[model samples]
Target: MSNIVKKFKVENGKGFKLGDFDPAYSDGFKKIEARKTLKDLIDETFDLQTELYAANKYALLIIFQAMDAAGKDSAIEHTLSGLNPQGCQVYSFKQPSTEDYEHDFLWRHYRSLPERGRIGIHNRSHYENVLVTKVHPDLLLKEHLPGINDVKDIDGKFWDKRYESIRAFEKHLTDNGTVIIKFYLNVSKQEQKLRFLKRIDNPKKNWKFSAADIEERKKWADYMDAYEKAIKETATNDCPWYVIPADKKWFTRIAISSVILDTLKGLKLKYPVLEKEEKDKLDESKKQLEKE
Candidate 1:
């Protein structure tokens, strides 16, 4: 499991390329084998989460970024199922609301951050400012920035600044006890097309199929380039990106669960121990309760 985490983790941005990863790779684990591994990982994560909540020293921020139909939702659902709801918060960032566009790109995301001792899951995150907007430069126009008056104005220097902003933002969060884990579900174009077809073919899934999805699909190459650039620019040792394979949903879930469990274990969280005074008080209270 540690090897799998290391294999997919991007700790440094230097010379990173998304295409180097195989979307269908499963690390020799069949579905049956992965199921058992996933269960054990989830159970351990649950126990660690309890200690984490009691310690109240660190907040886990898990971010997922992917193309359409890359199984981000399902992977999150299956992997984080064992978490205590009271200690977990999930935010799915969609098309920016009117209010969202009015502030700096990270404003809404900052508002949604989890407090210490909790886990926050972002379905799609502030990376969208770099990934989606980089792919469709026109979206920056909606941000209503002074210099970004036209798509043409969003040049190489503009993108470099956004990437720099992201790196600084993540650094500040990590310094403030936010443990960030980023995942990029690397789904191949062929698999994405098949998933899109299934949504269209199944009556129950028809609602999941959007015409806009196809429009995004048409720019798959552009998205890939943007993702590569974003990962290369912002990945750091403290905040690495895990490019998880998404062609096989089962494998994706297992890999993600392993990474999360590894992260929690690294934190070395422990349930708070009572001091001598508190222990004595508890003993005295127990004696009174017994008399009653």
Candidate 2:
């Protein structure tokens, strides 16, 4: 296990306080130092991922949930660099489409799960059903779940039931060989504001800025409350959430890569063993090739 993993992990997530974490925390690595560490992490991941692909047993699911400008995209781009693209799939969940609205909240996410021997990365995941929806309960009417027409009746029990659904969903995945690691990029409001401004000022990044992002920023407290409650309800020993500081993009990238590499290494994966008959066949084939 990596020493840094525990530093960011949300153990016994119930009653975990988001306030206890610092979004600007960087483990004392300045940008240049962190960039060097990031390179090393990316290099080490390729062999580990090849082992995972060869072992063909466990699938890894990485979930990143964060407010705008928290650098989820950069984290995914930087941390997973040099990974075998064939062994990985990344999905970024956006607003639910009409098709998404017709199914259970987890259905869309379920379709994107990684198969055995692969890594599935969710830029934003099913947790949105709790975090964003919890912050904006009005969005629930769109789901059209049974017995939820009256928004007034949608009380604590409704959210609690949703939390139960999330727990069961993750537990089911764990039982079926999928390992889940959830990350909440804890970015400060001030940092997010600065990032958003950068996006606005930079021509290349102007399109990335959304008025809705600023609108969402206004409700940061509500989102934080929702995140706290959802993490409390759904976090477990099998599927843990890591709230990583994101004020420094470099640090976020390295920290995330460390957790991912540590998780993959901890699996203790091995290549498939060949039987004597298989070994003999390979040796014979090698001899025939030598003759050719």
Candidate 3:
């Protein structure tokens, strides 16, 4: 296990201040140096994932949460680039549809759980229900939970239940052979603004920029508070939240890849062993073919 990865993990996310984590902090690696390290990590990941798939006994679920333009998309693209597509799946959760609103908050995410022997990556996950909805409480009205009302008077207890629900949900996954590793891409507000500007300046990035993203930026402080509390409530041993610094794109990729490699290694995954009977059957078939 890498000691540096522990620096970024929130064992107890309680009192985690988004401001305390330096988004621009890097381990002094230039792009050239970082990519070399990253390549090695990716190779390790490919071999590990191959074993994970063949073992067919465990599943890995990776979730990413971040502020807009915090590089979630690119991070996913780069870190998991070496995986076999057949053994991996990526699901990007956007706003819910009319039908999605009809079910409980976790229903949609439950449907997306990775099958055994595969890796599932969620771009933005069910945590949004607690983070984004907590920031904009009024948005909760749209889903219309039984006790909620027009008064907009939800108390802390209301949030307590939601957090409890999230914890229990993850615990169930872990008990059932599913492993969860979550990442929160923590980008500084100043870095975010600069990136937003670059998006506006670059013609190719224009489509990524939107009026809604600007509006979301206006509520950055509230979002930070929401993320802090949500992470504090739900981070657990089976499902830890890694707060990755996002200002240095290259470093962020390497850190994420390293953490993922360490987790997979800890699982001690191996290809399944064939029974003696199975081995004898193979030998018999080979001998019969030779005789023919």
TM-score of each: 0.98, 0.97, 0.96
Question: Model 1: how large is the Cα RMSD against the reference?
Answer: 1.0
Identify the runs in model 3 with alpha carbons over 4 angstroms from their true place.
Answer: 288-292
Candidate 2: deviation at residue 221, Å? 0.5
- The true-versus-predicted C-alpha distance at residue 225 of model 1, in Å, is 0.4
Q: What is every candidate's alpha-carbon RMSD to the true fold?
A: 1.0, 1.1, 1.4
Ten-residue region with minimum lDDT total, candidate 2: 1-10
Clashing pairs in 3: none
What global local distance difference test value does model 1 have? 0.94
Error of 1 at 191 (Å): 0.6
Candidate-wise lDDT, in order: 0.94, 0.90, 0.90
Count of clashes in candidate 1: 0
The per-residue C-alpha lDDT of model 1 at residue 242 equals 98
- Model 2, 26-126: lDDT tens digits are 87777868777888888888898999989899999999999988999989988887898999999999899999999989999999999999999999999
Deviation from truth (RMSD, Å), model 3: 1.4
lDDT of 3 by residue, 99-203 (tens): 999999999999999999999999999999998888788888888888889636688889999999999999999999999999999999999999999999999
How far residue 45's Cα lies from its native spot in candidate 1, in Å, is 0.5
For candidate 1, lDDT tens digit of each residue in 161-226?
Answer: 999999999999999999999999999999999999999999999998899999999998899999
